[model samples]
Target: MKSMTSRAMRAIVTVSLGAISTAAFAQADYPTRPIKLIVPFTAGGGVDTVARIVGEELKGVLGQSIVVENLPGASGMRGAETAVRAEPDGYTLLLSSAGEAAVNPHLFKNIKYDPSRDLAPISLVVKVPNVLVVNAASGMNSLDDLIAFTKSNADKASFSSSGVGNPQHLAGELLNRMASVKLTHVPYRGAAQQVTDVLGNNVTATFASYLAVASFVEAGQVKALAVTSSERIPSLPSVPAMAEHPQLKGYDVTNWFGLFAPAGTPGPVVDKLNKAVVQVLSNPVTAKKLADLGSYPSPKQPEEFKSFLATESEKFKNIITTADIKAQ
Candidate 1:
């Protein structure tokens, strides 16, 4: 009986070793087929566009076609859910914005997958800055003017954002917290409308995407008060950074995008993906294209990106908790 038990244990060890060898070999030759890149937003949207740009470059680097699939919905949760549940093979990946990867799970209740646990970070892809703009006709010329206006007219003051619990919304909330002013929050389904309402003076101001407000700002239709970054962006050199304010030096919120694979993916596979992403982002043409969209490439290795995500998650959670902000 002892001999039989010993033989059984040997057999089990042999089988486990065989499986390990097979998986390692597979990971070594990762992407034997086309890789699917999921974008949790509709085609032509910012996320999708960024995914395609990176995907196109990845095709050349990996020597395999990168297929982009849009699975937008549930506030960008659908694609995240699908990606998280996918096989831990390198074939499936997600190019996610800050909302899905860091904010949405906290903003919305009962997310099926925890981003920090269920996704393997590849690299940070891009960072986008929002320009807080008010209608040029509002007679509000600077951040100080806007703060004073909102403080004195709290009952009538309002600000618009792309949606609740996003960077734009939280930026406004951060301003309220540090400045001790109460600006009524107004959510918009579309950014264009956010600008439209601001232009119409239907809302006092908006934390608008640079793309949405660029032409308007150049056209002098909306006043670009300050950008939501630690320093001014090159595209809008004259505009000040939110943190430049003496009392609001801590103000900094940016919408970013990153690449991720399903959790439990092999380390070899993850490393290869991160390398490809970094290479793609470093190309001059790719940088120019992203720059044209008002975004800039900012690449980080898996561990670095993971750390950044953690910091961002905590910041979002603290704001949401303090403001009692929720999505219905």
Candidate 2:
């Protein structure tokens, strides 16, 4: 009986070693074929554009073609759910946005997958800050001025956002709480119409992604009051960050895109993907292109990216809960 028990234990050890060796070999030869990158938004959108750009760069690094697939719906949940359900192999990846990865889980009830549980964050591709803008002719030149104006014209003051649950929307809500002013939210389906309305003075102000509104800001159609970031972005050096003011001291809201693999993917495979992305982001040409879109291509390794997402998730959760934000 003792000899039989010892043999059983040895057999188990041998099987375990074999499995580990197979996993190691697989990781070493990852992307032996073309990889599919799932972008959970419509083609030509910010997330899709980023995925295609990164995919082009990654193709050269990995010596494998990256096929970008668009799966747009459910506030990005559809594609995300698809990615989560994919096999935990290195070939399938998700090009995720702050909405799908951090905000949507809290915004919508009965979300199919928990980002923290089902997705492994690889790297933060780019982060774009939202800016507070008023119609150029609105006569609101600073954050203080905007606050005072909103207070005086509480019934008339309004702000527009691309959508109800987007980061820009939350940023506006946060401002309302922090400054004790009531600027009613006016939700739009997309940035183009929202910016056009703001320019036409249909809304008193708007909180929008810097990239979405940068062209108008440059054209002098909208006056940027403050950016909702910790510091001033290099591209818009003249605009101050909201945190610079004492009343809005803790304000920081920015939209970011990240690369993710289904949870339980091999660690070495995740590392290889991270290394390839880090190299892509480090390229000057890529950085310049991202900058042109008012996005900063800042890549963080797997663990670092995971930590950053945690912080962002908490921040959004609080804002959504306190503001009583709900999915549309």
Candidate 3:
């Protein structure tokens, strides 16, 4: 009987040791297969471009292929939800825009995943400044002019956005709230269409990524009124920021992109991804490429990025409430 008891205890100990060994090996051999990086927006947009660049760099750094998948729908909810439900093996990750991670939670009534609980923030990839541009023929020149025009024609003036509850929409809503003006919102299928509409004078104005409409603004096809950043963008120094506008007191809204992994991914795996991201964002070439697109590389540590997202989520929640924005 004593011998049998001893054998049982030894077997239990061996099984525990084997389990520990397998877990350790799994952590060390993370990404032994290709990794999927899901972008919650359409291809050729700012978020998609950043994901491809970072994914390519990660492939080189991790010695594994990183595949970028664009699953654009429901203002980036579909792709984000897919990433949230993926196995927490560090093999499937998300590259979500600020709207998906920060704003959509407050705007949408039913979210399939919680940003804070279902996903782990890896790093902030970049922050893109959204510029307020109007068709040159529309005669909306400066921030003051736009505000006056909107106020004077509150019922008639309209603003275009990539979609309802997107960053562009939020920026416009925030502006209306702060400036005490009313502008009808015209939601488009995508940013490309929004830009085209603004350029064609079919819409009164639009707040979009400078990279998307910089050429049109520079060519005098569209007039840049103000940026949503706290400071002037390097690419468009002449245009002032929303904060610079007296009527837009304390207003600052910039779109951000970040990386996330499903919750329960090992800490070491998260660290590995964070390290690779920091290395990529810190590269001068990468910085320049992002800067050219009217954005700046963030490259924050995982904890800091997570904290930042929490704060941004709170901020957007307040904005959505104060602006009286409703889901459509």
> What TM-score against the true fold does each predicted structure earn?
0.96, 0.95, 0.94
Clash pairs, candidate 1, are none
Q: Mind sharing the TM-score for model 2?
A: 0.95
Q: How accurate is candidate 1 locally (lDDT)?
A: 0.91
lDDT of each structure? 0.91, 0.91, 0.88
Q: For candidate 2, give the lDDT.
A: 0.91
Which is better, 2 or 3, measured by lDDT? 2
Q: Tens digits of per-residue lDDT for model 3 on 48-142? A: 88888888888888999999999988878999999989999899999988888999889888988889999999999998889988889887778
Model 3 pairs whose backbones collide: none
Instruction: Tell me each candidate's RMSD, in Å, in order.
Output: 1.5, 1.9, 1.8
TM-score-superior candidate, 1 or 2: 1
What value does the lDDT take at residue 258 in candidate 3? 92
For lDDT, candidate 1 versus 3, the one ahead is 1
